[model samples]
Target: MTRCRLCGSEAMASVVDLGATPPCESFLAADRLDQPEPAYPLHLRVCTDCWLAQIPPLITPEETFKEYAYFSSFSTSWVEHARTFVADAVERAELGADAFVVEVASNDGYLLKHVVDRDIRCLGIEPSVNVGAAARDAGVPTLTEFLSPETGAAVRAEHGPANLVVANNVYAHIPDVIGFTQGLRALVADDGWVSIEVQHLLTLIEENQYDTIYHEHFQYYTVASAIRALASGGLTLVDVELLPTHGGSIRLWARPAETAGEPSQAVTDVLAREKAAGLQELSGYTEFSARVAKVRRDLLRFLIEAADRGETVVGYGAPGKGNTLLNHCGIRPDLLAYTVDRNPYKHGRYTPGTRIPILAPEQIAADKPDYVLVLPWNLRAELVEQLAFVHEWGGRLVFPIPELSVVEAASSKEVTA
Candidate 1:
């Protein structure tokens, strides 16, 4: 944290100190409940020189990804997003059957299945053994290996350079920002396109999405800083697309410097927006910590009030971000009761630090909790529709981020903060 991960600058400014929490995805089994758990400082800092927001590399990708619990296929909306992205990328990149596509951190082949459907030769470099095996079982050719510079070169040398390299939702996971970017550069053809999607720091701050801050995400990016990060590996920012995934994300289209003519007008527009938000300077981050505090306070107040009223409250998703929210707000099983998730892997496991019991999604319907706290608020629209049946029991859905919001399950109307 003393030096910026992207730039070696020693001048780092505090963004928000989320105190300490265990690795967000480290769900505890029943036997481990009595054992001691480790925690790390979760402070976020921005490089004054590069304006790149990052946390200390207390945990390594190997520790987190080797036996990963998260599988992208569990979320239907995310799967559809990947399908649509593959179609769009294929058309945009002019990829054909003979073309080879590579995806970094391709979790459970959520995306490459689309590429395979089109008869396009593709490979998935996935770090997680379990999820990677699942990907292979799903008929997507996957390499169970992390993407280092050497790994990238070996892949290119064996299978030939990739026509399109797709990295979505993982650009922020690696601690070695520069080396990971270089690995990406090594995977793609000299003139090939590299499509990367990462959560935009602008929406993260603007929408009070502090829950997204966790150990897994090593760094946050603004277009201004992203341009600099991409340049470190000889990649040039070409075009950018603003996406609605994971609250808000940026789909960065980049290429090798030699063939990357000039950045699109979209890049200019996003940079302008970032600048207008004062993200290039300390002004943009000054109010974020206060806003994050308000979110925590508002959420805790609602959960406490609900418990006082003898009403039941449960969480909807056991996402990593939800752990951060639960830990930061000091919510335990007493306040939330028990949360339900569609992912069966988390059904019998307890949340990392908060120790909230995770049940199957059917538990919500079976128990008929008065309030269902939506942890993965980024998928608000999708979850709201899916959980509409909660209204049958007069249940309401509570969203903790972007301010506390209580919406009627049936009418989908806002109740109160």
Candidate 2:
């Protein structure tokens, strides 16, 4: 039986099978091209017992994230998002110089930089050696190792319990969901809160975000399922917020079960809405699978037709989600000439499964392809603005997911006007 990673429930149903794929961010060096890529089964399953959505167990944290290529500081929007999160968290938790804040999967200290600026004690637990070193270089003390129950206890023993534990977009990446949450409980102080931001499954299905599916993302989360998982670890969901980042995400605030407080109305409202939407029923997942299949067909057809028309197409943003979409859709360099990335580390590399070249964003401006495929469709607005010069050559922007559409305007300013 393929049991659930969280509750060990055998009652699970396959939601979507994305087939064999390499780790999304495993961009390869030119010399390593001939090195065999280990592609694993990328299958999503929803646990009937706990309602946690997860992928079939295949890879470990050590295999996936050590010496990671991604740096949070690479994206301007992400950096701004981190800064905003730090400011808001400090204010909401009433954190001061004496209060300690801990962040898990804190990449390159992008968020903790703001916390340190406030003179508050901050520590980052990053598993990737390269990214952790970058964080330390940025003056943020970071521990380089996977965060498990043992590591959490050790951290607490060394630095004391944290007043706030921030985990942004990491709740779903862990294969051992239970262990990770237990670690949170062990590290947080009595009054401290653990804030987790995950891409909401409900939003993923509704927005046709099948691109977010990959081996690295071991699970998909919804508030109801997350609450249950947290409860199992002696944590309670006290508050929740719907965030616009990463397509659509939910920021959930939790505390130890012993803490006394009423759950936020946001929690009750979203849960009730989810229940009404039949997320509690297996039928919801079935419908989602059907919708995902349709999107795959639509995207492939559009790309094939565009190729036949001799239209030059290129991808923007070498995000993990983009890799999943391309690999699942079986897109290669022939379909997309190359993908552009702002991260210098990834620029000269090749995408994992598709082996498509990744270049600097400057390539998009210089090439000025007839069509620029916006892989991170969630940031379409921001990217379209950034590439406004493409209009000079009468090039159009294409967004495949959610729906296929060609956006044409002289410039971003003209489009808004």
- Backbone clash pairs for candidate 2 read none
Q: Tens digits of per-residue lDDT for model 2 on 1-417? A: 288877888999888888888988888999999989989888888899888888866887788788788788877787898888888888888888799999999989999998888889989999898899999999998998778889999999999999999999788888888889999998899889899999998888788888898877888888999998898778999999998888899999999999938899999999997887777788778877788888788878877888999989998888888888888889998889998988888878999989999998889778879988888888876787787778889888878778777776344332210
Give stretches of model 1 more than 4 Å off: none
Residues 70-131, model 1: lDDT tens digits: 99999999999999999899899999878999999999999999988999999999999999
* Total colliding residue pairs, candidate 1: 0
State the lDDT at 110 in candidate 2. Answer: 93
Estimate the TM-score of every prediction. 0.99, 0.96
330: Cα error in model 1, Å: 0.4
| Alpha carbon lDDT of each predicted model | 0.94, 0.86
Task: Looking at model 2, report the run of 10 residues with the lowest lDDT sum.
Answer: 408-417
- Please provide the root mean square deviation of candidate 2 (C-alpha atoms, Å): 2.2
Which residue ranges in model 2 land beyond 4 Å of their true spot?
A: 409-417
